[model samples]
Target chain A: MDYGDSPEEGAFRDRLRRWLTEDRSWSSASSTDDEYWTRQASWHTALFEAGFFALAWPKKWGGQELHHTFEVIVDEELARAGAPPKPSLGYLIQGISRFGSEELCDRFIPGLISGRDRWRQGFSEPDAGSDLASLQTTAVLDGDEYVIEGHKIWTSYSDVAEWCLLLARTDPDVPKHRGLSVFAIPMNQSGIEQRPLRMINGVSNEFGQVTFDGARVTAENLIGEPGQGWALAMTIVAFERQPAELGYVARYAKTVSELEGDVRSDPDSTRREIAEHIAWAHVQSEMLRLHVCRRLSERLDDPDGGVHGSIDKLLMTWTEQSVGQAARHAAGSATSQAGGDSRLGTYLYSRSQSVMGGTSQIQKNIIATRVLGLPSN
Target chain B: MDTRLSSEQQALVDVARRLTERLGPDGVVSLDDDDRVARLDQATTEAGWRRLRDDDGDGRPLASGVEAGIVASALGQALGDTALFGPLLAADLLRRVGIDAPGAFTVALVPELSSLAVADAGRLPAAVAVDALGATSALALLPDDGGFALAAVPIAGTERSFDLTRWVSSIPAGTELEEIAGSRTLTGDDILEVEAFALSLASADLVGIMRGALELTVDYAKSRQQFETPIGAFQAVQHLLAEAKTLLEGSISVSQHASWAVDALDAGEAREAAAVAKAYCARAAIEVCEVAVQVHGGYGNTWECMAHVYLRRALLSVSLFGDDGVQLAFLAARRMGV
Candidate 1:
């Protein structure tokens, strides 16, 4: 089995690297939370314009229709260049393109792809975090619109997004999973109220809590059939678990390199324990990177989404947490000093890695029941 | 890049698996079956598995590191008590020095068994011969100018080992060594490549050990009843097995890359990859084996259950080159200059 890039992939990677090296307009650092997000948006637009975003999407939807490895290359190059992460909208794009109607895709995908319109996913509530299927959100059909009323906690990007893809119960009599439906509701409506939540990293704009009093969406905004939201949500999460698509491996690599550099620049002062931690972190990063590559290669043959995503999610969590801990230890006193380095924020944010996408326990449960064919109570 | 095995590699794996399953020991008791052990050894020798790294007349091996790793993994899964890795490693060392291996031989490591042994003043120092079953001699490195000269030291005696499937021997202190004629001096890069090969094989063996242990435990979980139902129905047991499976998959990914890198990448790069794989697989195998034992409950601790055998084999592989801590320290020194 070959691990090096194919000829076409090598050429594409070289071209992308050259372009990234030549472009320095989007490299400015931001000071405020608002400025950070604004810069992220501009970076996203620049990537899309340069054809480095959504490399796996269809050409008809403003993508190059290249292999997913191209996407991985883009992530690796961007991280190597110390650029802001590529926009994390691949899952949303997957959900809409696969489950949304033709008119819905035509109406929303181009805008989302081009970064002209931003979106947030409203999947979890205070009571329905891990048990998402048990959500009590309701969406009722009334003439040409569906009135949605739900409380969504951890609604990321809600302040900047113009639309929110929501999951609400459409038929209550059936099982929880079967009764759900997805909707593309406009976030600018008067019935929706968004309150930004301060994250552990002290960033408020990254996450919000939204209460939909009586949000209205046209019936055409329904993603799929009334009972298809569960499948669509699963598909979206499976895509989200892919570390390659999410650029997690690249980010971890960057962290690992920086840690190594820190230890190297002051070897006489650095402790062996910290050096070992950095080495351990490097090992985790390499494992995750190689694991993601193999998974991406497997997807080339079997594109069907399956329980394998749970495995990827677990590995990603482990790598992120390890790298965060290594960075914290490497930073030593600097982590807690005034005007704290970013390592403290990173270490704190890593605490949510196992909690945000799916808890480690939940991922294990999925692997136990679905992948291992273990019986459940 | 493709990570899946090619058709030829898959075929090699199938053949190795079939041979081991047919002749290799089935349990702890079978390990003492001299007739079966001899038959297995004869079969592997006839199959030319040990000759995978033998020179192909171009100073390169007849097969790549992936091919050798596939066989190593198969042998590990079946607990095949054969002289494959030792002889193969000896051949690899000889090939690096542009000489054909004379016969069945293994590599001599320092007393701690952490690295290759270096001969001093035309005599072999006290060293260990790992995987030395049925081998006449072990190869050592003799310091020659800035490079190392290849030497063969006679194995003095076999010693009892924690791992029952393989044998270890000792080289007497100040044992006279003979340098092979017509051999070229090997560079530092050549030694690193050999270490990479050794580490990759060890990682592959750990992967196989984990696979075997998990499969055995999974089968037991499916059949062993508790609380009027199979214990596999319980979330605790299922999670243990699931986590073990995840670790096993991670080990496979890293090991695959390491084995491929041995022949496909530069010597330094390949060594780094192998070090990463070895570190991950060494730690993962212990945990996976422990879970296997835990899932088996009381029977797991017994000698007859076969779970302990996998653990024993994994322990040996973990110490073969260097455990996780050793690898991490080496990596830290290399990457961070610590």
Candidate 2:
């Protein structure tokens, strides 16, 4: 029942704080979005060299083979330091380490761990968003290669990623679930084109409407069996939806304190309104954080207790959206005013929290059917 | 950082759950019956459940806050016909305030439960609305000898309360009041300790009530059918129940932590943790009960369905110490250092 960090964890956290304080590059890492990947890559490399990256992975794969607590500690420290998130790093490293072939692992794992390369998740499409198995992307078998042709919407950081973990249908005649295959496609190939979609926040999140027309992936790039793409995608997305996605609740705590400060600093007229908003944000954030921490603790105890991920997804969306709304409420009329701050834009961006990583409605359905064991209609 | 309950704690919870099952609705004919309430209370006291906070022969607390919390949460989950809270809380408060009492009774004068207005000070007693049921007396603060003193005053009359399971007692004027041993001027830390226990136990109760209501609704949804399919087959019904389940689960997580904080954290931290738990659980419990009724459709609204019972208890608990608004304001004010 003790929730405080262990003595070891406290020491690791202090060390991390000292390291971040000494590293001058981290101060500008988040502000330099123009070179997001380059800045984030170097930061990730620094974290790796300092033995903080891939904490849960085996030591042979450039990881420290530490417990999940180290990962949780790192997540909290990164949020506290305000470092830019290496969004796809977890998916890329865990995906390859777990399911990729030996040669595939030797080729891509080191590069990813060292932060020399980045990967983009290419699972969602315009027609097949939540029903991801119905993705129309095709990767037909060619001579020693799979020629890929498809359009991927909302592929985050696609323009910056050197590689893409793309899910494409190889045998359309078969059932949608069994006909799919995943490929590690080189994003720099001749037929790959990425058009950045400016987010509602007026920031290029590096999200792109990527078109892969006859983009060829070598035979060695295939991950797992051809029919196993659906399962593989599920695995990767599960990691994306876990409490790891909440960044160990530290990020939300930071947002809440910032909002609380805003509420207190405001004048009397707006104080009550903003106070209520902050209260809701603060309580809901704590609720979600506690729930996620318990879930992670459970997972640490029992890895097969994996089906409750939809709960985390739902809570994450609710908390993020609540925090965004509270931030906007704190600003009041200034939210609509030009040249104030990006809080309003961030609120707009929060709308995607429910949309991406599966919609809120979809998460509800999963909870109802899979977790609750309710009859599915 | 371990969140799992220890084996002893697990055993305590199991025993508590067994007690609830034996005395809950399935075991008792009517929880509102005074005879039933008294009988349940006696049985629990005989089982040594009433003196959990009392000192053992070695002068150590018989049970820790964490252990008390487990038992309280289990009793809360069952929310049976027993009058456990009053005696348990009274015992805990007596230990903190350094008082010794013989029987099962509740307390007043806490910010969440009741407050006192000092009038002419003497041995004379005054009437106050104390939120407790099935207790011999209530410990309230009275203006005595130019300062506040804790007294165990006899209950003159019992009145109906919003929480059907518990009764609000009316203290008559000029009743005999026995002051507790070592009772004197209260300190700020004393109030905070009482609040920490009250709020944590109440939050745990709300979590249990929510879980109980949600489980009942899910069972009903599975068996009840419309249009040649179980109502649970429909996404509309399923989503409602799913949301209720999520709320229950989340409340449990927070409430458990709050309970732990009460046992282990310092007074200031424990107070804040209790407030957070109470605020969230109060809102969540009310929501879970309301949605559980909605999922049940018509039958849920009937008195026989047991949904209203949950709603009644949840509503009563939510407002007892201060509802979500009171707690949030307290929390926000603390955060602002106001």
Candidate 3:
């Protein structure tokens, strides 16, 4: 029934905020692929060393074993203090802890927890984006190893990561969900090359298509079971449904705080739009807290659950595109006349949030068929 | 984050189900007629339908009112009785706002109605629409900065088509209607929330009707023979029936989600969620009802069959609150930050 954090939780948030503000190692541009992989890995190691990354994870694996609410509190507090994003590796590590096997965890979690390395998601192929079932990546079993050969599009930060988290078909004759396996494949091996995929947003010199040709990785590298990759991929769908501006709390607060009164000023179309954006922002922030409530309830209800993650994913994508649109529309000439380094450039760059993760139409399809109970066809 | 209903909410669902079951499939059909309004009147007075709202003649709070919405959603999914929603929702909404609406009060449904015209100083609905209407008791007039104004003409002597579930009349051209009066100002988000509430309730009722049609056709398909095998066994009939099941389930989910969104309205997100749910539900209801007729074969074409009623209701329900386009526009506008 309580809508937000208790005093105890608030204090915990304050501690996280203080730490982030004080951490000289944390850089605003740390998430960019151009950043040195070794430096990012070292930073991630520091996070795990301090028990900042895996606080929500169980203690058996050198984690603080806190609840997701605590993790959420950390995220919010970090944002409050303008903390740089915890490396993608740190975020994806949670997915592994949720779905990876003991063997896989043993091989990866320690290094990941210690920030020795990171992994990229090799999910989409030429023909597979919304129709993920149509992915053509093939992984053939040879005694104890899966020799994978396929092209993965939109593998963000692949070149910067030590490994790629790949989804490949192992049993093509079965249904799509039953034919796929998830792997943490090391990318430095021969026959693996990542070619940058040029994007409309100019920020994607780091993201590219990765081709894995006869890339041999042991069965031990498989994160989940041979055919349970779909479930594992869906493990964090609820996380995707987070509110409008996620970890960008300090930035969002700064942007909207500067624009609030101008939006209310009379005699222009921008006023209504800006005011609406602020209103939307407030609503989105509250919904994020509500999302926290939904997340908190998961552990209490179904510790191991089956609710689809597509709904969350879809909502998150929508929120991202929306906030980006609001920023530009509210900023007027400042958004369009970009020359010197300004937020307008960054605002425009945020446009790919939907297309990068998954398109809006694809999200709707997921909601319609999987979440809303409509026939897929 | 915990959206799971408490055990008390769960019990309310159970109690509502028992009531729907005891009342049977024909329970909703009975409510469509003026004579059958007594069922809800008595039920609302008794223990089941108004568990939250009709307590000791005092109104339920907004949050409890939300629980009631969830109950209605479950009822629609289970029994397919779409007829009883209007009065229940109108009365419940009235209760949430602290308005002491009567047990059998009716609501305004004219599409052309607007609060600006109603609340304007000089203009008003005809006197006949206000007082001497056929059967409608109250109007949800719009209030501008001044007095509440009659939004609809509700013209009398227009030769009524359907009367029990709804009514028509005329009102004075410039009379000042009653304002909500109590100290409450609905925000834009609140407006969207109410719209979502109303639409979700209606769409749940639509689910009920769709289920009723599916049941009717399925029963026919089972017993009725075509050539040699029961029509139900044929692939053609099977596909149609299966499709109906998908549609019924689809509408059920949207309606369910929309209800949950409003019930747990931690913020204004319910508006878009509601719009999405309403748009999908509207499309599903039409699809299910249309296919229901096709599955029924020749008998479905006749007015003697109740399939036509489902068709009529489906078409009517699509544009009742707002059409698919209007709602999506509302949603997409907000989404695009326009």
Off by over 4 Å in 3: A1-55, A62-103, A113-116, A123-151, A166-183, A189-191, A211-267, A271-299, A310-377, B17-41, B48-51, B54-63, B71-338
> For residues B1-338, what per-residue lDDT tens digits would candidate 2 score against the true structure?
55677778888888888877676664224765666566666777777876887756443457766777776676666766555566666776666555665675776434335333222344434554444556767776555454455667776666767666666776656666677665445566656766787778788889888878887888888889999999999999888877887777778878888888876788888888888888889988998999888988898877777788888878867765678888888877877542
Candidate 1: stretches off by over 4 Å = A28-36, A335-339
TM-score of chain A of each: 0.95, 0.91, 0.81
Q: Which of 1 and 2 is ahead in TM-score?
A: 1
What TM-score does model 1 achieve against the real structure?
A: 0.97
Off by over 4 Å in 2: A28-39, A75-88, A91-94, A245-248, A266-269, B27-29, B32-39, B56-60, B109-131, B142-149, B157-160, B172-178, B183-186
Candidates in descending TM-score order? 1, 2, 3
Error in Å for residue A81 of model 3: 7.9
Ranking by lDDT: 1, 2, 3
iRMS per model, in Å, is 1.0, 1.8, 9.1
lDDT of 1 by residue, B1-338 (tens): 77778999999999988999899788889999999989998899889999999999998899999999999998888878777777888899898888875686899998877789998777787988999988888989999989998888888777647888899997878988888864688899999999999999999989989988988888898889988899998888887988898898889989999999999999999999999999999999999999988999999999898898899999999987788998999899999889
**How does model 3 fare in lDDT?**
0.57
TM-scores vs. true structure, each candidate: 0.97, 0.92, 0.62
For residues A1-377, could you state the per-residue lDDT of candidate 3 as single tens digits? 33245676677767666667677676544232234333556667766776677665667666676665565665555545444545544346656877887776877777666656666778889889877767989999999998999989988665677888888999999988789888888888898878887654445545789888998988888886778888766553334333311343333433433344444443246544455555454334333334444545555675543343444444344344445556666666664454523345445656665565566455555544444343334
lDDT of 1 by residue, A1-377 (tens): 88888999899889888888898876533221444565777888888998888888777778888877677777677767766667788888988889988888988898888899889999999999999999998999999999988899988875888989999999999999999999988888899999999887787778899999888999888998888999999889888887766777767887788788888898989999999988988998899889877888887778764568888888888899998899788767885577577776778778888998788888888888888877775
Residue B155 deviation, candidate 1, in Å?
1.7
Pairs with steric clashes in candidate 2: none
Candidate achieving the largest lDDT: 1
